[model samples]
Target: MGAQKIVRQEADTVGENPLRLEKEKAEQIVDALNTDLADAYVLYHQLHKHHWNVEGAEHLGVHEFLEEAYEDVEDAADELAERVQTLGGVPHASMTALSEAATVEPEDEDVYDVRTSFENDIEMYGSIMESYREHIELAENLGDHATGELLRQHLLELEEHVHVMDHYLEDDSLVQS
Candidate 1:
């Protein structure tokens, strides 16, 4: 057999949750979370790309920071996937599903200077952070306090990285042109 199907939980459908949330509300939370999960993966890949291509002054520091940022995004995506499962929903696993669900736009495949890369990263992080804020409100509104709290924690780190990058982009840097 190629692969016999069993225990199917379609991505669009919600099953029973131990927390006893209403199916409709649970579905809303699932949709928001899946978007967050997709955005995190996109951020992870873009940051990884920047990490690989970074150059110029402070290249080592920028490269290392990109790795750290992407790792954090990867961890966040894992948590989001698990949270979807906990809420009795199937997480978006296919690249197409994720891309469809994602609200954040990633940079194109072309490599750029570290400044341009950080600028793009900052933009991506801003969108994800904004979505997290909205999702946190949605989760709390639906009495999914745990999910809200999870995104809140992630937001703090996201802000911290943006702050550091803002400093990096300050005009006091050693660039001649």
Candidate 2:
């Protein structure tokens, strides 16, 4: 992939209003939230890609699962971006910015077995959960309750996703020998 040029937006002229949280703390939380948002966006696209291309013994099942997963991820990404705006920081809207900020790396668009796809998804969820945990801890330490709560919800959802993926792997019936 070619290197993407990142264009930074000019600072907004709106004077700081009266949010109780310290500006520095809020900025830190915003930074973390933006990263999470970018990761979510990338993951969303990955899930969508898999949804369209997945084929195997579990074709329909994996297809449907990816549909639901990507939808949920899209919603979560929107929420993360909105949270960044609420904290008075510009959300990373450009693909370049998102790619730069994201913790999730895009996978090669190669045909893979259902098992491999599931394994890749599981790994991605693990990385996302790790980032969520770190952000949650940082938010709580900064006394940014709202951001912490938002991240906690995401963390729970990601944990459930990981569990479901693990279950898929554990169930031998889901895999064709």
Candidate 3:
């Protein structure tokens, strides 16, 4: 009788569903999704730029890696934009808007040396990881576990890119020596 009573109480509490968000949480989540979308779009552009311009003997290696990176970034971009729209926010569309709002800088063709590319990629990935961390935290705070998990996966992939690029950067120095 005691166990049955306890189960009834638990079922009643579960039916009450205490985790529903007030309006503020929804607004915060939508804002975060929009900001992340804009940033991801900018990063996609940078990766595509790198993919098109990387040269020398490592061109094939770098080009292939960059293409993969950009593809991932492009997916993130599309997801983010759609997510923003789903939340009723307009994603930044113009190049000027993206450039102004982006945390990462636009890529410069003149600075496309192997060493410079590696260094810039590291910097970009670091910025991206940091931003993703913030987004993950925000999503978690808003009880958006799915978004948090996605950001975690994205952060891990970016970390791997940074590690692989580190090797290339080191190798570039050895070649000069």
Candidate 4:
């Protein structure tokens, strides 16, 4: 067979071509996913650290809730990384990458207060929700229905988390003297 035929055979064997426009679309989705994953991971670590070290009246509630959120976000990060790898791209994990990509600001050393923590979490979750929604849109545009469906489920969960955190933060404001 000719060289072009061999290239076509290889491409067929490996499934979709990764260098095409669709792969670029996949990469675009992965870029947003990568940023969100980094942000979520950073927030997850910060929440876990705060959970261990928080010293206040709502310590247990805050710690336990934050841990739950952390677990959810960690799972999401794993799935997104796998998706990135599936698209023949690397998912970033370094702290430097997280710092640069994070839409959620770094956890303040002085932000140990329950209300502050909740506010930070609400902001982070909101950013994540937006990214997930955008990923869903991109998946739809690319005709990747399976990815779109998966992203919808993840977006729903993120929305719920954001709503719950928002409620908690609002309640915290109300409870303040």
Candidate 5:
């Protein structure tokens, strides 16, 4: 052998590390977090798309609100991915992976109406909240306090977004009768 090449595998790739939690428990938590991360990413992109495409008298307001909402969601996605890495797991890297793992479905590109976008957002937020609660409980049960806390924080932010969207839906001015 004229030259020998050494291939290096990362902790995540090899699934070998000095994590204190049981490997199974860590994997479980990571899997849950990854799913949540996927949902967050999908929601973020949906919100951004709606922000740009939203049309009606309240278009400016809805666009600004969606911008803020998506920003928060982006932060949540980053934190979730970081938590997965901290737990000695690899976060999903591809759009296909994120889309496949996500529980929240994206709206069709043709659906650009403001009212429909808000309605879809509210529904998506509800689904994400449910997933967050489930993951939080699972993390707690598994003694992954860090993951639990991270999800709890995301839950609060998502709840705020839902509240805002609900208020918008309640606005009579926006409703067509």
Candidate 6:
């Protein structure tokens, strides 16, 4: 049987949200959350790829770190999706939808050295971080304090991982050039 839409929730319409945020503001917040959700999935997959492909003397450490980071990204993605739903918006779930909505780019399938992977990861994380900052401000200006707080927490976590990745890039670090 061919897949078909049955009970379709219109993409552009806002439903009854318990949060009671104004419709326009809720729509804006939902759009931001969906974008973050899409970016999180992209970052998660990249981290998972690096975790599987990492090699060299520092392989074990880098691999474990990537696993932990990917897990965290997954958690954040879940939160973003939940927030989107709470705001009466459909969360972007399909790969095409997510890829289209994501602002951050992922690296290609080629397996790079750990250092190269970390460099790419750092760049993606930075982009996501910047996006989150804007989202937090957007939420705050819209009087959605809950969403702003959520983004703020995710930003701090992403920043922590980026800091660790930066140290891994240092000349004296184990995963170095």
Local accuracy of candidate 3 as per-residue lDDT tens digits, 1-177: 465544332210112222354446655665666666667786777778778888887789889998998898777777776654444445566777666667777566574776787787788788878888998999888887866887787777778878888887764442333
lDDT, candidate 5, 60-111, per-residue tens: 8888999999999999999998888878788887988888888889888786
lDDT of 2 by residue, 1-177 (tens): 999988554432122325677778887888889889989998888889889888768788778988988998988999998887777778888988898989888789886776787788888888999999999999999998878898898788778877877887776684557
Q: Which is superior by lDDT, 2 or 6?
A: 6
The candidate maximizing TM-score is: 1
lDDT of the structure predicted as candidate 1:
0.91
| Candidate 2 local distance difference test against the native | 0.82
Q: Quote the lDDT for 33 in model 5.
A: 89
lDDT of 4 at 9: 28
Candidates arranged by lDDT, highest first: 6, 1, 5, 2, 3, 4
lDDT (0 to 1) per candidate: 0.91, 0.82, 0.70, 0.69, 0.85, 0.92
**Where is model 5 more than 4 Å wrong at Cα?**
1-19, 174-177
What's the true lDDT of residue 93 in model 5? 73
Stretches > 4 Å off in candidate 3:
1-21, 109-111, 172-177
- State, as a TM-score between 0 and 1, how close model 5 is to the true structure: 0.88
- Give the better candidate number (1 or 5) by TM-score: 1
lDDT of 4: 0.69
Stretch of 10 with least lDDT, candidate 5: 8-17
RMSD of 5: 3.4
Clashing pairs in 5: none
Tens digit of per-residue lDDT, candidate 4, span 1-177: 666643322211123435353766766666766776787788778767767776666667767877787788788778877776676556776778767877777576765676677777777777777777877888778776666787787777777767776776664453445
Global Cα lDDT for candidate 5: 0.85
Winner by lDDT between candidate 5 and candidate 2: 5
> Cα lDDT for residue 84, model 2?
79
Look at candidate 3 and give me any clashing residue pairs: none
Better of 5 and 6 by lDDT: 6
